[model samples]
Target: MEQNNMQDLLKRYLEGNCTPEERAQVELWYELLDSKKAAANEAELEEDLAEVRTRLAMPFRKKGKLFRYPAVAAAAAVLLIISIGSYFYFNNKPSGVPQKANKLLATDIAPGRNIAILQLGDGTEIALDDQSNGAIAKSGSNTIYKNAKGQLTYVATESKEDETDNPVSNSLRTPRGGQFQLTLPDGSQVWLNAASQLTYKISKTSRERLVELKGEAYFEVAKDANRPFKVLSKGQVVEVLGTHFNVSSYDDDPSVKTTLAEGAVRIVETGGHRNVVLEPGQQATLDSSNRLSVAQVDVSDAIAWKNGKLNFNQSDIYAVARQLSRWYNVDVVFKGRAANVRLSGEVYRNTNASKVLEILAFYNLNCKIETNNGVKRIVIE
Candidate 1:
């Protein structure tokens, strides 16, 4: 590789585009410099690392904060990260860092922000992040707005004519590392979590206000005695008149969880006769094997994501890894025998990936950050 292209190579390595040999060369280069006090240009290496971090938009490690971990997998007492001066190396490079760590090496994934996509009734898509705080579209008798608080709201206006029959639908979708809030035509409020979608009927002629949920969402439904609000998720229909609840039915999850916070809700099986009526502080779970069960639970843990926190209360490492993966938009891979670990902690959703990994390290699990084609992955050993 040309001397000048080292920057390019580093970027390729960070972006997961580098070949195996190229990656090894980069790590070998790190090994050569970790302790080598060769009188070469120290300024050049510093500039290269800084430029790579900037190009990849990685968060810089704090200058003096030390990452402490106990003996973990025979690697306990390993100091994972030192102040922003530790050298970056490849897999299984070493057990410890040198005297001074390198400044700004590329590898932290940022947390998700307020982001979502809105599909208009006619099929026009609007990226919520790109639009300003104003009316974004008109749906029948309602005007949609990206409000000042960044919520997609449907405000009812005087109707000139009817736009109904099959229910004119508008949808909101949040990609990985994204979330959004919106109000429906029926005055219901919804908080769409990361990698989730909510499609609500905008037409007022329907006798029942209906919406389809794919991933997960928190609903604060508006009470309408005449029109019962129904959410059609995978295998179940959550019917509510006026209540607050959460439904998690992601494809990756092993079950569909419907947690009720306030009021009451009835969970009806899509094609079966199984049903359960839930009261406050109750949870109804529909498992993969088509089993329906209800239990008393703490509802806060269910809506923690909506309130800007990662609550891993009574969660195993795999569950924690999945939450981290969705929030940080990273894939998680276990390299060796996976740890039999369950954890309980609350971390704000606004922090970067390193902060959460540091929490994992505290529990003695080895976590590493890797990248491929602009996506970050959390690798555990």
Candidate 2:
């Protein structure tokens, strides 16, 4: 290949877009680069490796290979490719960096500010984070209370309009890595996840109940079959008469997932393009391309965050890093290839940063934990 063609091939190889033959050529090109020279471009080298590894993970149907054990198989394939090139590339470099050390990016979501702003219908904003957790407002004979645990609740108060007491609604949002619980006017319970926002409006006892969510949340909605409950996520809407379920629709996430625990729910995407009727114990995933898929998953695992547990079952390194980022409020940067290390475990939600890092370290993954000026940086191996 000419110089330009070689450069394009290198770029494509690093982006995980190269074919198997192109991959072989990449090894030869890396062999031509002197290690002393390459070491100066260490960061670029790592990026290229990440992209290559990502491409290796793609399924190869032509190979007639079953996709079972995708992560392990992909890791093995990438390792084979790296072995072909590393002989020439690293022999000339210094031995200070361990040959077997895996450099991984420790990408994590920043910690929550333990902050929330309540927007009432009257356009009043209440800074919930700074206030003492207690009864903060009253609506239509219903008392609004915020507990020390950061949960908001509503209780019935005397009403002059009729025998039945009406409920009120308000907006609640938790900043990144923070969580709060809520009891709606209709006696429905909601647990907001980090970086989540929800809006609830008051309703008469006989009217429909509606709310909006951005990010993850667990809902134990009050049962009133006469009045259906609807939750609006970014581009999808979940409508249920009375059900217990969880919905994750973080705009940053690639897909919208809704897991149902009990009762029934109708998940509808915008423009009436996709619709799914989910049953209890069923989870639905809506991708950016508007494809809908349903599968059976353990509801307990899906809603573990609400119970103060970080549960993982056969989860990959990237998935684990995501959970840690949300729970501990740190940033995770992987230094090199993050292998297909499947883990099944649980950690207490309130565990300190070092403890979490120590647990991750046991997985053959190196981690460097540092805190500077209240910001935590977690570097992965």
Judging by lDDT against the true structure, name the best candidate: 1
Each prediction's Cα lDDT score? Answer: 0.71, 0.67
Clashes of 1: 6
lDDT of 2 by residue, 1-381 (tens): 533253234334433466768766755443344343354444434544444356445564425643322332333233332332343323433232223222222322233435567777666788787778678876665677877778788776666653334455578888667888888878899989887899887867647788999989999988887888999997889998788999999887778999999999999987688799999999999988878889988787789788776766567888778777766666778988986776555444664554455445445567776557867677787
Query: Which regions of candidate 2 deviate over 4 angstroms?
Result: 1-115, 159-169
Score every model by TM-score. Answer: 0.72, 0.66
Error of 1 at 194 (Å): 0.2
Off by over 4 Å in 1: 1-106, 159-166, 372-374
Looking at model 1, report the run of 10 residues with the lowest lDDT sum: 69-78
Best by TM-score: 1
